[model samples]
Target: MTGSSVLSVLCIYVVLTFGSFITVIKSLETQTQSHEHYSYDRVINLPGQPLTPSVSQFSGYITVNKDHGRALFYWFFEAQSHPSKKPLLLWLNGGPGCSSIGYGAAVELGPLKVNKNGGLNFNPHSWNKEANLLFVESPVGVGFSYTNTSSDLDILDDQFVAEDTYNFLVNWLQRYSQWSSHDFYISGESYAGHYVPQLAELIHNRNKDISENPFINLKGFIVGNPETDDSYDYRGILEYAWSHSVIPDEVYDTAKNVCNFENNNWSKECNAAMEIVFDKYKEIDIYNIYAPICLINTTSSVVGSDSHVSSFKRPIRIPAGYDPCYTPYVQEYFNRTDVKKAFHANTSIDYKVCSDHVFNLYNYTISSILPIYTELIKSGLKIWIYSGDADGRVPVIGSRYCIEALGLPLKSPWRSWFHNQQVGGRIVEYEGLTMVTVRGAGHLVPLNKPSEALSLIHSFLSGQPLPKDR
Candidate 1:
């Protein structure tokens, strides 16, 4: 009744506790397997429209079905000349609804720029110079990216963009089987801060399914002047304007005192504060070497002669004859027999240059994907975020706020990385992640300072420390 009874009771309690724990563990494993097996019913891939003049060059396009309807994406792929080994870089341009083709082709990675005759000019700094670059006109109506059916902006959220992009990649690799062995990386700017991470998460999730999917080897990601967080991004804009003396001190103080950065909703106070700042800084030219008025009339013609143009100090435009540097020109380009033959979009009716106008009409907010950063780190993918110091839109301070939110442990002291004996940027290494700031660049890092951006990207891809040429 004493020692034996007490020992029997203790043993029974231990058995019950262990059984409960095992049941809970088994339940969790079953749920995990269920989620793994859950098939996404909406993913549908269309035919691959490959571009030519092959010669191990950059070119391709693929049709895909989005929530709105059938859409087209013009892609540019750069193949390694040596033929054996090369990485694939998927580049996206951000506007919540902008064209990657406009940004990638006219501005950043692609070799061609829109000439004054509404033609293509070859660019030497194209990302194709290093890795195979792929650009997509994403979120439907951004550029050459368009939907067949007329609807109210069907695919506007982050999830839809990620899913559609993943499906497109799978079908694309199927068409170009050679890309199956290539390593992959996702790079972009502006809203691409959101696009890149979402796509990266999708790739990581899909990799768990197919054993040989080439998209699985997604090595890393690079974002320039990324819009990661809205609260800090807007606040940072004011801080940047104030610091650069773009806004009066009084206006900056009024903004700080009246506006609530946390509530992104438009307020009279916020508007008034912004108005005051804009009124003061309206005449200050921050982007170019010229006066502020020049920045406003971004599309104005160059005043000097062709010889002077050679040494012109004006802000870069998308050449002449084409639309504004940032405007969509897919419809304009594809409508031409030459561009149609180049892209193989001949059969399509009335090509739409701007797809987002038709596909992403509703306002879509992207705020929760920040948690995906953890998923990327857990999967051993390197992530790098950089900001061009002079860009007021998505300033360096915004990046600092985003990095702080990551809660990463610093691995090295922050220092400048250089190129050609100049301070190109500063680097911060933390827990295998890298965040840097380009010294004299703007919203478009590659366009404003291609060499510096390329060097940073090359270093990240190779898993090397940022270059120090000081």
Candidate 2:
């Protein structure tokens, strides 16, 4: 062979050998990752759950306060499809004490639905369709979340709740750092009106102080049927009851006139009027005025509790609709030993849907989250306030009143938004804020109107307007 030809052959051999060396290193690295992917958080299989090969599920604790041994339980479901492309969303349930896993995840928007038979079924409208969903049993003593220091239960307040939640998010990001860059949003309903906004403020404020470690990618928040202002909320409820003929004109007038509706303190007259309102509310589901109140004794066998059976005389019922009593079934499902073990939950503590201790002892530091909302909105966070129109608890009227109080310039006037070629809800947009009312939905909008709820959420995460036509 010629010398030049020999050199060319040597060059070809060197190129091939170097390429093979790089490939081998990459292959070994991939193998190392495959072996090291082991996670204490990895879920093997859930008892009684059907095989879901495509989706990933994780559950366990993130110790937020090590000194107090404070840990929060979390259940996360990767998006049903294209999880990598989806946003990460953390959902909270309000009661200032409700289990997000039990109420928000299982019953409302999670992939699992607690059936009347105490079995699990797929929620066809689960929010995982749009985002990677995480549900935490927040604050100490709620669901599987607990604090070794039992006194942590007694002193729980908005500040503590917000701080703990913020810590959970930050530490959670550290553990699941792959999602640190994903567009993130915090969401909840009811008293989470307090929880969600307060936590968002903390995250936002912390993000601003970049001198300190910041939650750099914190995006925005969405709250539904939130308990924002005691006064506006109460006034809205009274007005809603009268407008819907849920209460008589005289009862409504008394509530409107006698109640301060602007502060936490209530006069005797206000208390009396509220009593009349409560008496009337007993006949129907207060959460969803139009929803069928659960009168069935489904819990006799599984739950072994007669407390769930309503004593109210059955009003003429709608046969085919959302069951207002759906929540009790969820409580029973969570209480099951197998279910708790499968989720890596606190097997020792009996899970209650809403912790009575949390409700009673929880010091509500603020009657209105309006100030927080005002400051956050000014910061240009994507703040969306949505309400289930049929919810009497924190009715649409009240949410609108709170938004109007923000005094933002209107970006979009109130108009009906469509889904599946039908009017799903009405929405109004303002600079850095949007107010929405889901048609026919109750306090739990996703539970009442799942399809519309999914659309609303998909749009929010996509930063697009909700579908306006079929």
Candidate 3:
């Protein structure tokens, strides 16, 4: 070998040796911090709830901004088995203001369900059985996440949410470094379509920029009933409604003529035509047209009142096992002084299923997140979009349109996917994307069809197609 080549080889060896030393030191420091956090955030008891069906869960705040007292709340559950070897999956629920805690954790995929008596029950079908799960109420204005800077609430947008969420993940990883090298996936439903992809793109781009150890090994992302392309979302909403007879044909016809959904602009005629849809939805729960609206009286501030709990009445659909009146119970449970104290949540802050302030002022800056999806897909990120076909709010129709707009080649034709000896749903795979539909499910697929949702998650994480056989 030449003298110069020999010298370069020696330099690389020295750098590698030194890098290993630094990583060891870093690992020790991160582990110490993680241990400290474990003690602080470990959930001792959920009021009136039984022991978790599995390992353990923790909930608390991770300060994203100390200067502004801006902290995001998180509920973390370890995998049921082999947590150290399992992937770390972050779950987000989108209302632009929804609580991942109230919705995703408590009602949807969480192992804990708040009961009618303001108690908690163990959910057997939680996603944690497959992967370590984490849920965050993001952007510092929703759920237990809060900020002292009131002005921060006013400027909430997609970029703001993504940046804050990213900050939380980085800090959180350092505090739980054992999972730093594990595969990580972000999944959510509803408005999270925007939140999920936007955050994944940010992380993917940031990972490319990062040359050091603080990298999040983001494997893929999945979103259900997501609000993707605004144009497509609107079109899908109208089409799904009309096809399902939620609105009259004449009204749908008028809307098509007057509304420029492609650009999200509407005329006076368009507004009037669309009102028919809003009016019709009032007669039904728009999220799940077939699901009954919550008839229980939650109007009174009487917290935990059993007065509204009526005699046993079977739910319209038994498969989902979600109550229309459930959110109120969640509200009652989380808002309790004892529960907040146990959760390490701020007693002063009022918990909400969705923050109207954040929702109203949430500056939705993007017209379409399809561009972000295309970029991530090309970057080789596994992308999947699952839709609860019955969700009128963000139906499968919009998701299909959004996927088609990407112009990816079909990898597989649509086929039935089974769960519990029945056809659970359908899946259509693309070159780098997969579209899934949960039959008879609404906005929250996991809540409506837990078994099917669990089955879908299993397939996605394993990088396998949904089971074709029994």
Candidate 4:
């Protein structure tokens, strides 16, 4: 061959050789990662926890922003059985600033929960039975998650929260490579109405690039008693209070007329009228209107504190179990030095179920999540919004209004769902969304009615319908 022809042949050979070499290296990397697990974050036992061999637990941090020294903490539980076959569900608790570990894992639906003596007890109805549970303390300042940059807390808002949570998931999946291919779902209650859908939207947008490795298989999201729209939520709170006999008709009427909930301009009369609502909720638990207020617990106030009222419409109240002491028990348990050591939390950091500081500073930018819901419905992701009929804060009345505003065609008419041979609650299906209610349950369904809530989630994840016949 001539000199030019020989040169071209050599160039092609060099390119082919490099390509094969890179492919071999990639194969080796995949094999190595597929077998990799972070043993350091594994939890063999908690300080006062019982020995339950049904599941594996791990707790640790994932740095979302290295430049800011920002990290998010997580408590992950493998499925009760055959974890590999189960879907992965990440649970968040809304406070704009609450510890998912405290509210979600320890108090509500984790395999273990805080008992009266600051010890742990096995919860048979834990949601881990249906999915691999991942509980995250998000947005830097809640629980063990932290940021070295002081100013980071000043700008906490919907956008800031979504980005951090998305980054954590991306990094977390890389570390837990075995779960990278599993179906994923997001769940939470209260302020998470904003968090859950926004994060789902982020995943939906980023996942459009099908070529990306470790693709997030976000199948759907479910939120309980979420804060969807300002006007509807405000209106719901008033109407629910009046309907439930939590407030007098005059107070509700005064606020309804004077409050410009859409514009968020609470005039002096509006403020005074709304203050009566808060003041009345203080008489009983706002989140759980039927539940009595706690007069015995001196170590704690409410679940989310008064900060919740100003930022997110209302606080978590007494966790909906009617015990009023559950929050105090869990609060005391998580703050223990040994318990902190066991959960991979910062021993020096005092873990609050909800942080007053984060709530105070959180820039409440997003007033409504319906737009994102509208967009995600088009993406064909399974979306379910559930309500505890007894939830005074995000009442069923408001949820109905919010759902109605979506303007989706009705897929199923309102009907009673059966569990334990009796009516569990009412359920209705919209074109791409589903709404469920747990009868007599309060703000936190898992805390109030674990069996029904578990059944609700099982139906949601498995693509099955709530049984009308037992």
Q: Taking the tens digit of each residue's C-alpha lDDT, what string does model 3 give over 1-470?
A: 99999999999999999999999998888777789898888987777878545448888888888888899999999998999989999999887677888888989898887788889888889999889999999868899999999999888888999999999999888777778899999999777888899999888878876776368899899999888887888788889999999998888898888877775555667666666766676576777878877666652211211211221010011112246778778888999999999999999988888676776677767879999988899989888999888887778898899999999999999998888888888889999999989999988888889989998999899877788967
Provide C-alpha RMSD values for all models, in order.
Answer: 12.7, 8.7, 7.1, 2.5
Sort order, TM-score high to low: 4, 3, 2, 1
Candidate 3: stretches off by over 4 Å: 1-30, 52-54, 299-321
What is candidate 2's lDDT per residue for 54-154, written digit by digit as tens?
Answer: 45778888889999999999989889888888889999987766788877887889987778787877778999999999999888888889999989888
TM-score of 1: 0.75
List the global CA lDDT of all models: 0.63, 0.79, 0.82, 0.85
In candidate 1, which residue ranges exceed 4 Å CA deviation?
A: 1-61, 66-69, 211-215, 275-335, 346-360
The TM-score of predicted model 2 comes to 0.86
Q: Which stretches of candidate 4 lie over 4 Å from their true place?
A: 1-37, 210-214, 299-321
Which candidate comes out best when scored by lDDT? Answer: 4
Q: Over the stretch 77-195, how does candidate 1's per-residue lDDT look in tens digits? A: 45535434668888887656556765666656566655545655656566776677778777765555556665535536777777778877876665555566788899988777878
- Model 4, residue 358: C-alpha shift (Å): 0.3
lDDT of 2 at 253: 79
State TM-scores per candidate: 0.75, 0.86, 0.89, 0.93
Clashes of 4: 0
